[model samples]
Target: MKQRSEQSQGTVYGFLAYLLWGAFPLYFAALKPATAFEVLCHRILWTLVVCLIALAATKQLRFLRDLARDPRRLGTMAVAGVLIAINWVVYIFAVVTGHTVEAALGYFLNPLVTVALGVIVLREKLRPLQWVAVGVGVIACVYLAIDYGRPPLISITLALTFAAYGLMKKRIGGSANALQSLAAESAVLAPVAVVILAVITARGETTFTTQGVGHTLLLLSTGIATAVPLLLFAAAASRVPLVTIGLLQFITPVLQLLCGVLVLGEHMNLARWIGFAIVWVALAILTVDSLQATTRARRLARAAQGAAC
Candidate 1:
């Protein structure tokens, strides 16, 4: 019964996380007049404000203080911040400009890239099945790139940057609260945004002023959209197994792909379908392995508990 309850909680949290992420394109796509760069600036600025409020409310001021003195993890997080910031900016550009399918492809490729990053950066060994899954994903990308002539650079950039960000965050471990890390990262980007916005304003080329009041707040909503999901992911991650969370990662990309084909009207040719089928098969292999592994772990744990009792 206890196991069932935890599983249910994991499923619920995973779905909610996916739902928040899946619908993100709608929010970003609404800001038509403002370019992705302009919206990115506001997102960085407001997320910083929200992160500050969270720091004050939680009284984690000391963590922030100590963070300044700790160079190792702090520097790692700074690199992570740059990576994710670039990712967010590019993702926004992709979605706003009707490249939602490419954006979805980026996310779909991200997990496989993250798995590769684990091997490269963390020296983690993958199971044989995981290696096969990675191979399938790579072949799918290669095929897609061939069909497109050039590489899918937007999707490739998003995947690589985000995968690197995930690896870096994993490197940071549980030492920092989600809010604190976001605050620190936002702090890292805030100066550049200020300078850019200032320059844009001085030159009379600012989009924010003329885009009307409605669109501006919608852009601000991006920060909340970005941060709130991370907090939820943190909450979910703490309470759930890594395997369960891994399954949930598929939800966002699936939704984005649907949105692209049905809503945004991106062309889905035979090659795209074949590529997606390859990805699906890879995910199936990985997910089956994960489920089998989870079941074995549960049985062993329960047996150990019974022995103790």
Candidate 2:
């Protein structure tokens, strides 16, 4: 019963995390007076503040001390931070500039991008089905590009930057848990974020101060918006199976797509819909391949256990 309860809780946490992430378009849209760069800067600054507060509150200051001592880890995290900042700014630009559909497409392509990156960067071997999935993803991009008369730059940029970030995090291994790593990344980026804020303020184009109480509050909430879902995702990951996490991850992009078409009223003609359909088919193939592999691994483990007996 306790195990079941924990799994249930994990599912809820994972769902909530993805739901919030999917709904991020709405949140970013609310910060109208702020440019994507301004929001990105504030997000970095405030996320650092929140992380510091959490460290103090939870007595996890050791994370900071340990990070300070490991120059290699710090350097790795610094690179990861910059990559993530790029991802955030681009995503924010999509949301705030009426490109939510393109943003959603970006995330939809992210998994396939990650898989291709694994093959290239990690030199991991892909199964036949996985290879087919990747091929289909490429075809989808080509189709979309032809339809648009150009490459979907926003989508490709988001996928590449995020894939690079994921690779960096994976290379880092268990040097820091989720929260500690986030705090460290934010800390690494904070100085640059502060400088950006200063420049914007000097230009008298700053939105946070001039935008009134509601807007200021919305800008401040970016920290919470960034942190809370991450914390929830961490909690879910700690308790759930990897397959479950993989499946849950799709909820985010699916919701974003819905928000784009339904809420934001982005135009999706037959060509765009066809492109999206191809991507979904690719994702389905990948999902089935993953499940089959997992099943095979489990069956092998059971056979080995029986042979030992």
Candidate 3:
């Protein structure tokens, strides 16, 4: 019963997390006229500030001292930080340049990429259904490429960078808590961000310097926008099985796709739609396979317990 309750709560947290993340394009869109770099800089600085405040409020500031004692983990987080920054900037570029649909495609492709990484890097076994889902995802990519008359660079880059970021974070293991890891990453990026802000300010080209109050606030809010979903996701992950979390992750890109088509009014050709459908079918297959596998594992565990009794 406790497990069930945790799962239920996890579902709620995961839903909120992904819902917030799915709404990101809208948030970033509102910060427009600010260059992606400028927005990224503010996001890094403000995220660090907010995270520090949270850590202090929660009496979790010890994590920082612990991290400071471990240089190797800090270095690993530095690499992860760079990767995430790249991912963030690319996503912002996708939104601002009106290629949000392609951005959505990248996220749609992320799970497949992560799975491939797992198989290759971790020597993990994939169920037959998983292999089939991956194959279908590949077909979808091919279809998209053909339809676009070229490779989808934005999509592919986003997938690769984010996949790499996930890989690095996983490799980091439990070296740092979630907030600690983020704080480290933000700290690593903060100097660069500050320099960026300084340079732009010196030239009188900084958006915050020149923009209206509304725009400045929007720019500053990137910190909250960046941090909140991550906090929710961390909470959800602690309570849910990885498989359940995986299922919920799709909410983000699906929402982005909707925003791109309905709100942003991007042109979606029939071919692109068909390709997206194929990817969705692949995701459906993967999700069902994960659910069945989890159910089978639970059943086996219960049977073992009964047999022991």
User: Candidate 1 or 2, higher TM-score?
Assistant: 2
Off by over 4 Å in 3: none
Residue range 1-309, candidate 2, lDDT tens digits: 999899999999999999999999888988986999999999998898888888889999888888889899999999999999999999999988999999999999999999999989999999999999999999999999999999999999999999999999997888788888899999999999999999999999999989799999988988888999999999999888888989999998888888888998888999999999999999999999999999999999999999999
TM-score pick, better of 2 and 3: 2
- Model 3 Cα lDDT, one tens digit per residue, 1-309: 999999899899999999999998888888888888889999999999989998899898888788778888878889999999999999999999899999999999998888888899889999999999999999999999999999998998899889989999998987667787788899899999999989988888788957798998888888888888888898899999998899899999999999999998999988888999999999999999989989999999999999999
Q: What is the C-alpha RMSD of each candidate to the true structure, in Å?
A: 1.9, 1.0, 1.5
Q: Give the Cα error of residue 236 in candidate 1, in Å.
A: 1.3
The superposed Cα distance between candidate 2 and the true structure at residue 41, in angstroms, equals 0.4
**Model 3, residue pairs in steric clash:** none
Residue 271 CA displacement from its true place in model 3, Å: 0.5
lDDT of 2 at 29: 85
Encode model 1's per-residue lDDT on 1-309: one tens digit a residue: 897787677678778878889988877778886778788888899999888888989888788788889998789878988998899889989988888988999998888888888898889999898899899998989988988788889999999999988888878878887888899899888899999888878988777768788876786676787788888887787777888799888999999888888877889999888887887888788788788878999999999999999
Q: Rate the local accuracy (lDDT) of all candidates.
A: 0.85, 0.93, 0.90
Candidate 1 global CA lDDT score: 0.85
In model 3, what lDDT does residue 37 have? 88
Q: Each model's TM-score? A: 0.93, 0.98, 0.95
